[model samples]
Target: MIGVGKIKQYSNVLDKPLSKGKQEVSLSAFAFLFSELVQYNQTQVDNIAELERRLEDAGYAVGARVLELLCHRDKGNRRETRLLGILSFVHSTVWKVLFGKVADSLEKGTEHEDEYMISEKELLVNRFISIPKDMGTFNCGAFVAGIVRGVLDGAGFPAVVTAHFVPVEGQHRPRTTILIKFAEEVLRREARLG
Candidate 1:
């Protein structure tokens, strides 16, 4: 026989409110775990591009769940349907949830109407990473790109997202910029809606 307190009551556990989607892990712990993820993926891939894609795929899964949670808990289950709406949500809300801060910048591409970029000085994923000399231009932020893509795609704004490293004047390490090129259908839909 168990004591009164020792007996777990399902009602008590069920009565508690759900998290507001503000959960976080320490940066050090995240770095360690992310490193392990990279190391494990390294063994399975033949090249850096493949590894990055795999990581992006993993991030995509996380992003989908994140959208589901945030929609239910924080946003009152409202989904962003407009292009700018979803972009803002990903740039601000998603980044804040995942990285503890909003993205440094979200800008439209000067050369393309359908392209946008989310730039971060030192993205959380790339902060602790030290790329090998052989792995030229391999930004760990591909995982983050995946997250952005996942969120956008899940929210009915399908787009092609890629991560790039852009040199900043006087900065030793380049910043990670996520480039999002919306699908033609998405662009058409946007124009019609506007």
Candidate 2:
């Protein structure tokens, strides 16, 4: 067994409650941190896919914690049981908390009943990022996709979330669309309860 060194305990920090009032974080700070995260991940991977996967993994962990904290603070420690209800909560409440505003649009897939899309004109995480031309099919929104997946999974609605860039003719840049595909079991459960 390895001997453990004396560690300073900060139990009071854990005991403190999260503030219910609107708390804001500096956008510049977030941007710098995200930039560092991308740079660090990029160095560890050879391809765009691997780099994106690393970012998603990091975001997933953050999402899980954020979901729990938000639910506890705002939902009276209750989880949304309905599919549409959860989606609406994420679209409005979660989006506001994360980005200081709601998403541009939320729509269901025309071809698939279990698929949903949340469109954002500009994803906050991708604001200051500039992808190189060599990195084919790279969108920093993949991190947000992982966050969505983590939240849904934590709330018992397991789903796959992917980020896609859909260009709008008049827009300055392509919009980021988060495509969510709920699991079969989740849909079945929703149907049974609904």
Candidate 3:
């Protein structure tokens, strides 16, 4: 069919084997594409929440694919099984691959038993974005949160992920913290297994 041939032509690049050498892209090109994605999603939604949800949904798809490919590339085709193991993978490997560096800090929630946090001084997605004052408490890092949520859910750990901006006085850049809250059943299961 004509459609089938066209689809194959468009997707042929994806069929290529992964090479050992690093695959690099222009950061400016990515920033342009990402900005356009945000602008398009912004025009479709009435509220900040809806716009962020759309962005997150888009990131979720990318994260799902990245999880599979990165697991194969870095873990020798093995998948992480434990909560800590997956957290470490995300904090180190995923951050490195996505941002060209690891996150600033990974911390357990002090009050909550099922909550974890990953803090980045300058989130990659937010580096070029400037939220208008009218947008209220909007943070573009929600897209990254969605990516983390997708990766966890795909790895059999269903959780909610939220991104918050925490500004530090005397600091040049604000911090973005991604909070991950696992379901009660997941925590219970971990306890039972241990």
For all candidates, what are the clash counts? Answer: 0, 0, 0
- What value does the lDDT take at residue 53 in candidate 1? 96
| Error in Å for residue 164 of model 1 | 0.7
TM-scores across all candidates?
0.90, 0.88, 0.88
* lDDT (tens digit, per residue) of candidate 3 on 39-84: 9998899999998889888888877987998988888778898999
Ranking by TM-score: 1, 2, 3
lDDT of 2 by residue, 1-194 (tens): 22567544458986556567656899999999988888899899998888878888887887788789889989879988899988988898888888899999999999999999999988999888777888767999999998888888899999988888899998878899999999999999998987
> What lDDT score goes with residue 93 in model 3?
92
Worst 10 residues of 2 by lDDT: 1-10
RMSD, one per candidate, in order: 4.5, 7.9, 7.0
Query: How large an RMSD does model 1 have?
Result: 4.5
**Candidate 2 lDDT score at position 66:** 75
Query: Which candidate achieves the best TM-score against the true structure?
Result: 1
Of 1 and 3, which scores higher on TM-score?
1
lDDT of each: 0.89, 0.88, 0.88
Candidate 1 has an lDDT of 0.89
